[model samples]
Target chain A: MMNCQGCRDDLVAYLDEELEQSMQAQVEDHLERCVSCRQEHDSLRQSYEFTETYLSSLEPSPYLWTRISAGLRGEPMPVRAPWSWLAARISNSAVAVRLAAVAILVLGVGSSWLFYHERKLTGQARQEMVQFVADWEGLDVSRVNPFLARHEHPVDELEANPFIDLHHHDIKNPFRHEER
Target chain B: MKRPKTEARAEDERIGELQEWLQRSKQQDLEAFHQLYQRYSKRILNYIYRMTGSVADAEDLTQETFVSAFQNLKKLKDDGKFESWLFTIARNNVYQQFRKKQIPVGSLDAGGEEERSEYERIAAPVRDPQEEALYSELQHVVNEVIEELPEKYREVFVLSAIQHYDYKRISEIVGRSLASVKTDIHRARLRVRDRVKRYLGQSS
Candidate 1:
């Protein structure tokens, strides 16, 4: 009942015997009468056999095993540079465990100290901001008034209050890991 | 092709032994890794040869694959997956070579039907059956056709036909579905058939 196109479509799988029994029987029936489809199947089979047979004859060089073994022994490792082994050597060594622990300790302590210093600076900046705002508003620089002397514009009174810490940086550039 | 029951049992036994060898190789046992190399190096070489069609390059890449496998053996989470894992590295090595040549290496998982058809049309030109019969015996022609296949089809075809890897293992190595592997391999055969036919036509 199968046509030439259907048989041809199933040719590769049919050659491999991958078709189910019912479908296989249909394909066989078609190939029995359909000379052209049968020839297609034969051609597919020849190509498969040729490729398989030719490819199997290939053998690796004995020197390949020597090279791989030498590579395993670390004879100037290929791909990247020789120093790439440093990462592997370091990771495999027992010292890596202790180093990891020390790293964790340093990170935790450093973050905690950074938090405390940030809070202190934030408090100082807020206090200075409030004083600066109050003094600037109450005293006019161009006015000669008694109030100017009493208030003394906290900015003038504050030693080097140039640029009051408006941004409140607990540590300037806390994200800088190298400085930390 | 369906493996006979006895062959299946032998395969299971081989995998069992391979797992044991891998465990020993993990302990810096050079002899164990050598056993593994003996078992697989040639097969890997054959696969690479059909892939690149250069014996020298295949040998070098096979060596590089094993060496990389040894170095990164610790990263292999499952010993049973060693063969697939090693093949993945080998595939990557081939892709890296293709990258050096500035060729766009296609991934097995990235294959679309339209692209497969496009590549197949380009690679395989139709011809008479009698013509293909002439070049069937031409090993050099066979090698060239296999090399001309797109990488996506090339991986499946080489693994399935040349190396005799089952679809399941091929799926794992190529990182594609079992069904896709089967289809690519079949299409691969059809396309190779046409390419051979065309080669005969041109030669005639």
Candidate 2:
């Protein structure tokens, strides 16, 4: 009673002989009655046959065993190029470890020097700023106080001073025109 | 096809010999390990060649596989499963090579013209000229379709159809579930069949 779709779906598994006996019988009955399904099965089987006939195992090179045996024994392969041999040597575990250690040491020393240089510059700048502020604080304020106070007087008090020639110099009426 | 009882018995005897070799290999016997290599290297090499589509890469990967196998011989738990174990190593090496090189799966360029020519040169034999030409053409088409399949499907199909491993053994070799392997093989077969049919129809 398997439908065409169902039979087609299971056709692959059936071909592989993976289906149960009862299901296998069902597919068989379906194939007997169904021309389309039978053709599909035949085509699939033919594909399998074609593939098996056409695809064959390839032969490995004769020297493959020699290369493998040399590898297992930790000997360098004879046919490697000079650069490749050098590369292989560079990639050895001990060499790599030594290179890594040297790189780390250089980085550590460089960073420590940079850190110390940066701290030294910061300390010098801080000391210069402090010296500038201290010199400013040590200045004589008494000499500067009178100069500061002179400018603080009112305008009228300054007009009454003898040394201040307000009328002669026309300090207040500088813009006025007079006949005399 | 069902194998004859004699043939099956011979196979069992061979398996027995392989186990004995494995035991000695684990004990650091170089000669015994070499025997194992002589028995399985061709199959491993071909499996990798099909996977990679390049004989040069296959040779390199096969060497790596056996070297790794020799180093890890003591770690193998069951000597009886050596075939599957060896295949697993080969599969891992192929994948590792792919990963390191960032080669995309099913790349058309994987089988370069040079490699293809090399393959034909090595695989060519003295035969009837007409049949040889036809077979060469069909093989070219088949190889193209196989290379076009996604890696997952290609591996399963190659193992099942080319290597003739059963679904259970294939699942073990590829480290996939039996159900997944079955589905992949079925789909891969259908794809290949459709392509080949199309080619045949056109050629006729």
Candidate 3:
């Protein structure tokens, strides 16, 4: 039974569902009969929907993440390196942490490389010695005996035979040799 | 007169998950912190944009808000109220910006935050571009109406009509009594609808 002007005053409250049940029923009944009031209610409702959707749907420009990350680093990002994107995002203190990580990584790889190379060289050396031993094992000492005899110094021969001791009578072991 | 409990229970579970993330973030788990950021960034960004009425200003304030939050996250005592706390920080960030600019914030008579260019920049990725355009234009008029409202009314209106916050929560945010918040929200709606009525008349 409320006039349009009375209904207009209650419109916002009714839309918010703040009115009493009897009042709400009255507004509803009025709205059903009143085309203009109903249209007004519907328009308000639609506008509210439009406001929510429009404002909430906006997104920042794509490069905003880059800018935020750069700001975090305490470094100015003039040019972005794709490879160092994560590196660029870390803070100043974290830069030192990253440097330490890189150092550790280099040390690990360098140490492994050195170990592998040394092992490879050792393997090669062992193979060469094995081949030399096999080649010499056949007739080496007897054939070298004649050659060794021709160039032998008595002092050298004495030194080569570790059992012979020419000095130091107090030495307890007979296998001890001259110092030279 | 018991209400259906599923939605409330679901909200509680969501808060619990956020609490877990927040706890991990406090422990210096960057990934957990990033998860928290991902969960909230868009909403926070949007809120700031609305408050400032400038996309650039909103972006700057959003970053500063997160930076401040990141630095002082340990100060937060309650995990369940994280959104309220975060939004309070966002509000403060906007407050500080206005303070720096010496913007007279108390002038409730000074009308309307800007609403068009910022909105125009957004490209809706939906299939019907026309619907998106129409929606955007409708929103432009609606937002202008919202912005034109007085500050107190605008705050409650945004929180209730736009953000869909409960009256209790809106009251808490505005630091107003529940009745005042309700009145302001009602008044805001009336003003906005009055302004947008012409557009609505044409469209309908």
- State the lDDT of candidate 3 residue by residue for A60-178, as single tens digits: 54555565555555668433234333433332345657888998999999999988865565455545443443343343322322211221234457657777654534654222222
Residues A43-87, candidate 1: write the lDDT tens digits. Answer: 888777766654424555455666677778878644432442343
Instruction: Work out how many backbone clashes candidate 1 has.
Output: 0
Please write out the lDDT profile of model 2 over residues B1-204, one tens digit for every residue: 599999999999988898899999998788999999888888898788878876666778898898899999888998878889999999989888888889775453433444555546686777798988888777777777787888888998888777878889999999889889888988888999898899889989
Best-performing candidate as measured by DockQ = 2
Off by over 4 Å in 2: A79-180, B1-5, B106-111
Give the CAPRI class of candidate 3: incorrect
Each candidate's fnat, listed in order, reads: 0.43, 0.48, 0.28
Summarize candidate 2's per-residue lDDT along A1-180 as a digit string, tens digits: 899988988887788777889999999999999999999999999988887777655776667788888877789965532343333434445665787898899999999998786566545554544343333335333322221121234557867898986555735331122335
lDDT of 3: 0.66
Query: B64-165, model 3: which lDDT tens digit per residue?
Result: 777677767899887766777777888788778878878655232111222334344556556478887776576567666766677677767766776677
DockQ, in order, for the candidates?
Answer: 0.15, 0.18, 0.11
lDDT of 2 at B178: 87
Which residue runs does candidate 1 get wrong by more than 4 Å? A1-4, A17-26, A29-33, A77-180, B1-9, B104-137, B200-204
Clashing pairs for predicted structure model 1, backbone only? none
Q: How does model 3 score by TM-score?
A: 0.57
DockQ of candidate 3 relative to the true structure: 0.11
TM-score of chain B of each: 0.73, 0.91, 0.81
